[model samples]
Target: MTFLAVARLGRYTAAAEVLGLNHSTVSRRIAMLDASMGGRTLVRTAGGWEITDLGRRAMAAAESIEASLRALGEQAGGDPVQGMVRVAAPEAFTSAFLVPAVARLHRAHPGLAVELLAATQRVRQNRSGVDLEIVVGRPQVHRAYATPVCDYSLRLYATADYLARAGEPRTVDELAQHPLIYYVESSLQVDDLDRAVQRLPASPPSIRSTSVFAHVEATAAGAGIGVLPDFLAEHDQRLVAVLPDDYAHPLSYWAVVRDGPRSTAVAATLNALDEHVRSVGVG
Candidate 1:
């Protein structure tokens, strides 16, 4: 189990947190597993831990055992939706949708715990640690299921003061004159966002950040015209849409889960998230 946790999470500290054990204990167990297996299973890398061929075989066997145990528990009527459900998602959606969904789930299942990893990256092909992932575009995974959660729009926004100081651009060509605030091009991972940025007219002077929240704040503070999600920017009274109808990028949020029988906790979490997204339509 310790080996499985380590392999899934890729970091000793993260595995320890999930397993509710100290860092030393987790390390010792991995060492023992290596000794018993007669080969190195995992190696530390710049990105994280990389699993070896031997480790892949071990993981496959361990997963089968785990599935059998879960089936046995269900057969004995011991299936209860209570435990940890880890999720990886974008920061904006985590605050706008997931936090409230988890809160509601907690009220019904007090024994349930959730760990949310705020990230803005593509869905990893090897989804080891997280039970669920919410991404900006439709994900293509070999062994996973994806469902569209909601559609949102990204449009040009600016503060009234900024617009007054630098006249608003009436056409896409004219946008070149004003400064823009958006994600740093080099750090961006999602293709949908990249395409959106590519479609926009080039603006020389701009503020780039890795965070959408920062984009909203800078635009509100009269930094520059920001391409921001409507769900996030529409609520801020300080921001005014620049070209509501003329310029908009439509995007969908998708929920992804591993392709197999889900644990009770995972099922509950996914259901709760779906319900919340439906209740509050984004687009």
Candidate 2:
């Protein structure tokens, strides 16, 4: 189990946490395994450990065994409807939108538990840690099952107080005269966001951050104008939309599941998300 965890997460500390072992223990076990095989299974790197060719073969065999065990456990049912479902998505969406939707899903199915990995890092379909992913743009995994789950709009916003103080700028060119807040250039992961950046005025923003939450907070503090997702700012009375219809950037959210026989629980979770998108106005 320790080896499997390490192989799956590719990080000793993460594997240790999942397996309830010390970091040193996880490393020691891997070292022991390598010594027993009289070959290096994983090569240590500054970032993390990478599997050797032999380790890849061994991991493949281990995965097959794990799959077999899972199949045997599922013999009593078609697919599991109760258990943990790990979903990865951007932090902004998780806090602003998905939290309430997932809460509803949990209320309907009390036995199901959802593990949310809310971060900027993109989760891959082949990654063993996550069961589903809500991707911002097109997923790179071609073989994975992917579909557009929802559409949301982003528009310029400023605090009501800020607008009152600075005066509202009606057009893009007028908006440029005021201070702005935006994402850092290097941190942009979505192609569509780059286009949005292109639409910005030639003036540089007064504030920049890699986190969407920061952008929202800074904008709300009357620091500068910010482009934020409608779902996040729409409910906050403090924020007023700036040229919403004219400058709104349309974006689609995609749900991706690894290519394989999905469990009943996963199917239900996907269904719930689809329903939420349709029924609940995300924006």
Candidate 3:
């Protein structure tokens, strides 16, 4: 944890602060670890204290050890499928498909309890005490164990009232005239913008919220048309599909881990989440 903390935090001082130790103590710990391995674990440069190649390998090995430890715990506990799991996901998704999905998982695994850290904020597995994450974007994050769960197929949705008041849109061009609910897209570092916001051809400021979940709520409140993830919008009684088949913003849901499941509860929770996603299918 020490080596990786410094590596990830990118500052010996910051890492030292996090560990509640002096800077020299942190340096000594790194130096000692390096002495044991006979190679430098960190490199000093203009950027900051960066993780050397050796350090990265060490971190991976450390994570592998964590996985082994969990395996050992499962073997020792005798009951490997009982515990609480904390998952971080988008708010609207949590309020919609995720709740039903979680209920389904509870039905399947009676011993497992789920805690959702739902919001627009992206919480890292290592930084946050989260077992799994159901992220809708940037599925490919190196140095983490990830499994594919579902696709957040986003489409334009609107309340029937909003559509009735404001004329229906048949074409993408026609949508420009309507008061569309727009929001900030800052959950993950999306590389492919063209494929992300498929419902919107280009950015034009529809409503301007810092959260997609907020956008969904606003859409349900008859704010206007909104391009929302199907998982987050499917169960919204007030909101209905406007043009699901016409456009698609399919983002993958990843079951990612920073260091893998630490406790039996976390493991069970992850298992329950997997089961739920399978049963729900983002319909």
Candidate 4:
């Protein structure tokens, strides 16, 4: 009961309240859980508790046990393989790709459920309980599995109004005066990116964003000149290209996943992602 409550409520005190137990009792039960696993499973936080690495593993174990138990109940009826797949992806990815795929997945697999978590930060490995993560940049080949999804073409764009007001830039040198919106890059050095953008003779962007989607939306709203992925920019007639199509930039996108329990279901999902790659055409 304490375990279920803690997992449900995400805090010891709240779990204690839900279980109708004293706070100390809840504490003891959790400590027992730690002892059962031979280590601490969670760290106490001022606002709540964070599951430790071991706690994450223990949680998976508990889930597997529950699944086995449910399998027994399912055996009496017709049980298609059923489970919840947790996916971690950027807000843009959720909006652009994964969310649209959900409806078809549901129709194809009536019993399987997908839990999509929108994250502004880069998705960590399975240790963070994210079964799959889609990232925009170079694929991590070292991980259990990574597939290049698309080139994710990036180019300068501005709203029709913003461009009309500022006037279209005819030469690379003219870019210095206009307000531009850029992404504040990380992991990858911005110097190389800056050098490339400098080739266009642009003044630095007035507004910078970490989110590609945010940059796209802001540019469409006449915030400033910014880059947008082909998938996004192609759909919006309000946004126009600032640079020629031949302009060169470096970046890519990938879908990453950890090794799941060997199964046809997991393999099929990977294959599906691979198949989707071809459909993501170039800019």
Candidate 5:
């Protein structure tokens, strides 16, 4: 179990946290497993632990055992819908959607726990430790299930004060004369978002950040016109849409689940998220 956790999470500290054990204990167990296996199974890398070929074989066997145990638990009525389910998603989605969904899940199943990894990146083929990922655009993955969760719009927005001072651009071509605020071009990983940014008039952004919240904040503070998600900016009274009909960019959010039999807890979390998205359509 310790080896499985480390292999899935790629970090001793993260494995320890999930397993409710100390870091030292997790390390010691891995060391013992390596000794018993007669060779190294994991190696530390800049990203995290890289599983060796031996580790992959060991992981396969361990997973089979885990599946068997879970089935046994279910047959005996010993397994409850409770445990940790780790998810990776965009920062804005985490704050705007998943947080509330989890809150509702907790109210019903207090024993369940969820760890949200706020990120904006493509889903990895290996997946590391994330059970589910909410990614922008449809995900291309091997041996995983990808489903569309929701579609949201991104539109140009500027503060009323900024528009008053600088005047709002009426057309996409006119937008080139005004400064723009958006994600840093160099570090943006999502192809869909990058394509949208590339379609905009070619002008260096006045401000760039990895966080969508920052874009909204900067736009709200009169920094510059920002290409922001409708779900986030539409509710802010300070911001007004710029050419809403002409400049709207539609983006879809997809949920990618690792291929396997999901535990009851993970299934419940997925269901909660789906329910929440259905209840409040992403604007």
Candidate 6:
């Protein structure tokens, strides 16, 4: 299972999550498998894990066996809804919203297990091993069942201490004079934050991070004004919105599923996600 997962996802960490094992365990299993075959099954490179030709053949055979087993189980009337649901999302949204929502989902359906894949940025294309992918902006995949589930907005924010010390900017022009915190230009995947900065004249930022959670933390620690998602920083007592009228940027969340018949578990999980979004009124 671990070998198959690695071949599919191209990352040991992601494969580990799907297999319900630690990354080291996944690596160990792969190593053992390689030893059993007396050949290199996978190679680790700068990009990530890559399966060899032999490994690809092995993966195909494994998948065939898995499909046969699944068909047999279904014929035996196995519990279709009782299984794992892997969800992938951006880090900030996942930590702020999806985690709690998934917890509620598990409470409602204890048989369903969830594996969350939190990425710092979105890529145009990659080997994703998750069942459901909740993209903050538009997903690049055209063949999948992608839909805009909800929309959320981002706004400029600062810590109360920073505001008190530096004085809050009242307008976009004034905001240019103050230090800013934002995502690194080269690494940004979502257009929402990019749009927020584009609305204002370019200013030198005091801090730049790839992670939105890091932006929130730096802003809360009095680093500088940061453009953050409303749901991520709304309830925090330390952070306050600034230039709400001029700085808010709207962005949509999309749910992407593969092209196929929906499994009972996947459908239920997707429904739970949509329900959670509506319940929170973040849209």
lDDT of each: 0.84, 0.74, 0.67, 0.63, 0.84, 0.76
lDDT of 5 by residue, 16-114 (tens): 988999999999999999999988889987757768988878888887887788788779977456778899999999998899999999888787888
Query: TM-score for model 3?
Result: 0.64
Instruction: State in Å the error of residue 10, model 2.
Output: 8.0
Candidate 4 runs further than 4 Å off: 1-81, 120-126, 141-143, 185-205, 260-268, 275-283
Predicted candidate 4 versus true structure: per-residue lDDT over 5-78, tens digit per residue: 46534466655654468889988988899899999887766535656788778767766775676577568874
| Candidate 4 Cα lDDT to native | 0.63
Whole-model alpha-carbon lDDT for candidate 5: 0.84
**Worst 10-residue lDDT window, candidate 2:** 119-128
Q: Estimate candidate 3's alpha-carbon lDDT, on a 0 to 1 scale.
A: 0.67
Is candidate 3 or 5 superior in TM-score? Answer: 5
Candidate 6 is scored at a TM of 0.71
lDDT of 3 by residue, 157-231 (tens): 999999999878787777777766655555344444335555455544567576776787789888788877766
Q: Model 5, stretches more than 4 Å misplaced? A: 22-79
Error of 3 at 227 (Å): 1.1
**Can you tell me which runs of candidate 6 are displaced by over 4 Å?**
1-78, 123-127
Order of models, best lDDT first = 5, 1, 6, 2, 3, 4
Error of 3 at 170 (Å): 3.0
Clashing pairs in 5: none
Off by over 4 Å in 3: 1-28, 42-89, 93-134, 137-144, 185-205, 258-269
| Model 2 agreement with the true structure over 97-195: per-residue lDDT tens digits | 667777888887787888898755554534446667887766677446888777787789999899989889888888778887877878777777666
Per-residue lDDT for 251 in model 2? 82
Query: TM-score, each model?
Result: 0.80, 0.71, 0.64, 0.63, 0.82, 0.71
Query: What pairs collide in candidate 4?
Result: 176-203
Clashes per prediction? 0, 0, 2, 1, 0, 0
